[model samples]
Every structure is written in structure tokens, then in C-alpha cells.
Target: MNFLTLPERTSGRRTYGLTSVIDLGTPIRELENILSDYSHIIDIAKLGVGSAYVTPNIKKKIEVYKEYGVKPYLGGTLFEKCYYQNKIPEYRTYLQDLGIEWVEVSNGTLDIPLDERLTAISQLKRDFHVIAEVGSKDSDKEMPISEWKEEIKVLLEAGCEYVITEGRDSGSVGIYEKNGNIKSDLVHEVMKDVDEQKIIFEAPTPKQQMYFIKEMGPNVNLGNVKLNDVLVLEAQRCGLRSETFYLGERECRLLL
Candidate 1:
């Protein structure tokens, strides 16, 4: 068998595929410039946290991102903040008015009840493609791997397009250790309970990205990617570079 000609390589867009970038504070001009060059390789662009509130030109940014066929949306932390402040209805209206076609529902910061979280997912789905996030931001309050897996099932059943495994922006907590390495045993446990296609791992480092690609393949959905690293990450995903591509190839060879 040709080692590089794996059937898994044929997966299409918006599936369990590669290179989702996080726009933590990407200026609209810079975003436009980058997208003009590399939008085809990027899958999603998240307007991270409350950074979307910083500019009066956010709607214009959303328009440009969408124009390049990139699905842009509010970060989960922003949603959690809105929900906590009882601004959810207003939040939904604002997203709709801004022409945002996707939104994230997460309980990373706040103590939202599961049912309410599910309800928010349902409501968001009526107007936008909803992605839900599991796991807590607080390292001390991390949910067990088993619980996270089960919650993924619940979210998918309730119509969430995908569930993000919380790694926060630092990648030093949640599923990752203080040193930024993933707890592979916990990852293995979660993998047993959900389809990997329905999950996006929040990997913010090159090492973390390489780890997931090596263990879960190139199609593993990754988030919290830095804006400047978008092309670099895409190169890793497509085997365009030797550093990260080496591990990706090893994993693909094993599959073969």
C-alpha cells in the first residue's frame, strides 16, 4: 500500500479536519491580508473572548472573514460572560444583526447548569451553527475525563455542531499539564466516548498541535491557534514543513 495515500486524507471541509485559527486580537486589516493569502487552508476563525467588543468595526471584520469562506464567531468565554450577566437574548440578537453565522456556547467560566447550557445550544442553533465547549477554565475544578466524554454526547444529541475541549489560551490547564503537555491517558479516555470528528481540541502551542496531529491524525480539529501562526499551522497540517510534519507522517504510516 502507498503509505501517503491514506483514505483518511480525503475528508472534506468542516469535518474533523485541520487548522482552526483563533483571532485573539487580530486587527481587521491584518486578518484581511492573511486571509487574502491563506484562507483556503483555514477552517474557522474565533474572535477570542471579549476582544470582539473592542471595536465598533467588528461587523465589518465578520463580513470580511465570511467573504473568504471562513466561519467566524464569538469565543465561548464571551458567551459565558453574556449568559452570566443575563445578556444572552441581547447577545443572540447582536450576533444575528452582525450576520454571524456561527456562535459558541460554553460554561468555561460560569457555573451554568447542564440543562441551561443545552438549551442555549438549542436556541443558538435556530439562527447560527452552534459549537459548544466542555470542561472548566479553573484547573482545580476540571471535570473528570469520563464526565467530559458524556457531556460531549449530550451536546451532540442536543444539536451542537462540535464540542471544544477546553485548554484555554495558555494550554497549561484543563486537559494539559502545567508544563503544557497533554495527559494522553485522559485523551484516550475521552476518545473512547465520542467521535473525534465532533470534538475540537484547544491546542495553543506547536508542541501541543504536533501531539494531537501525531496521536489523532492531521484531521483533528484544533483551536486557540495564534493569529500569526495560521500559515505555520497550515503547513504542519498539510505536511509542507519537516518539523511538525515528521510526526504527522509517522502517524499516517502507522495507520497504513
Candidate 2:
């Protein structure tokens, strides 16, 4: 560790300042390599969408995450797919069979109503640590802050352990614009009444990750992080990187 003083942060079982990475088709050997080296700062590992269906030895993959102290979860899209096809019950069995204890409940692209979604969380929370994702994934479906606030509160109340603001895999949609900039005003308005600790902002891009660290402090929950960038993001959180050097006690002045 560096000798310079950085912002105070919590380690292990993070509630507010947490990092969740997306395992989008990570091969088993590569997955082993990344988790072995970079799992210290990671809190959760999401098997993105149906990638788990095609990926070999998913049971083994989940075991890898557990061995590294990182909880594994199936993406909400998989849940949506199952529920849409009248197989939510089967989906539960599948996850249980694999011994996964974390599950994401989201309605990003589904036609399911808000009430049903909340009910699902209420029930799912009984068996797994629920990570509910709120917000539309449609790039054109812009939601007002008022709706975001109400929906987040309702989901949390329904027993979700955490709520993720959808940024999609591309970092374009929900909480972020197509150009990958955060909708800061919306976030401030929501955090005004909602607890920031229960919310995870999906920031797939470095700039977006840095913005959340600056805005919500180093411990703000961030998700959808790529495997290779785990340490880079951690460095930013501790002001070890140039973008957030101002966060440290040491003076950092940019020169032209």
C-alpha cells in the first residue's frame, strides 16, 4: 500500500461502497485467473444474462466466486426470461441446484407490471439475497426522477437487499445517457429521499465509475465492472489514480 493518506473506506461485507463485476461469458480458466488475482475488492459476481446457460461448468464457476469470497448471482434478465416463459419456479430450482444464493430481480425489458415485480422480490427474498435492478433498459424510455424514487423505495420495501440502476452492459441506458454520462440531477433527487447504501449504480465505463466515486464518495456501490479493470477502479477509489488524486490529503494540481 502507498504511504499517502486517502479517504476512509470500509472493507468486507460492504453495504454502501461496494463493487460488483459482470462475468459476461468469462471462460472458466480465465475466470479462475481473474478471481484468484482480483477478487479482494470485488463484492459480487454477476453471470450476465443467459451467458451462464452456454458457459461450461457453471457450478464450477460459482464455486470459484465463493472460494474468493465473492458472492455469485444470475442476471435479472435470466429471471425475466424464465418468468416470461412460465418457468420462474424452475429457475429457482436451477439456481438452488447450483448453490447460488444471490439473485437479481429486474424488469428492464419485460412487460410485467410493477406490483407483480415487487411481489416477486418479496417472495424471492425469502430464499436468496435479492439484488433488485430498477430502471428501463430501453435507451428511448426516459424516466423522470419522481418515478425512479418511488420505484426504488417500493422495491426496497418489498425486501430487496440492494437495488441496481440499470446501465446495461454497454453503459448506455438507465442512470447514464447514450454518450455514457451520468444523469446527475436525477441521482441527487433520488438520493435526497432514498438511502444511497441500498443502491448500486452500474458503471461499466471508467469515467462513469470515477464520477460515482467523486459524487457519492469512494464507497458508493458500483456494478457491471469488467474483470480486468477491478484494480484500476480500486485505485481510483483510493485516489491512487490521476482522476481522483484530489480525493487524497496530498495536494494534486493539474498543469497545462
TM-score, predicted candidate 2 vs. hidden true structure = 0.95
| lDDT, each prediction | 0.82, 0.87
Residue-by-residue lDDT tens digits, candidate 2, 151-200: 89988888888989999989999898888888989889989988899999
TM-score of each: 0.90, 0.95
TM-score of model 1 vs. true structure: 0.90
**Model 1 lDDT tens row, 100-127:** 8889988888878999998888777998
Q: After superposition, which runs of candidate 2 have C-alpha atoms over 4 Å from their true positions?
A: 248-256
Candidate 2 has which clashing residue pairs, if any?
17-219
TM-score top scorer = 2
What would you estimate as the lDDT of candidate 1? 0.82
- Highest-lDDT candidate: 2
Which consecutive 10 residues in model 2 have the weakest lDDT in total?
Answer: 247-256
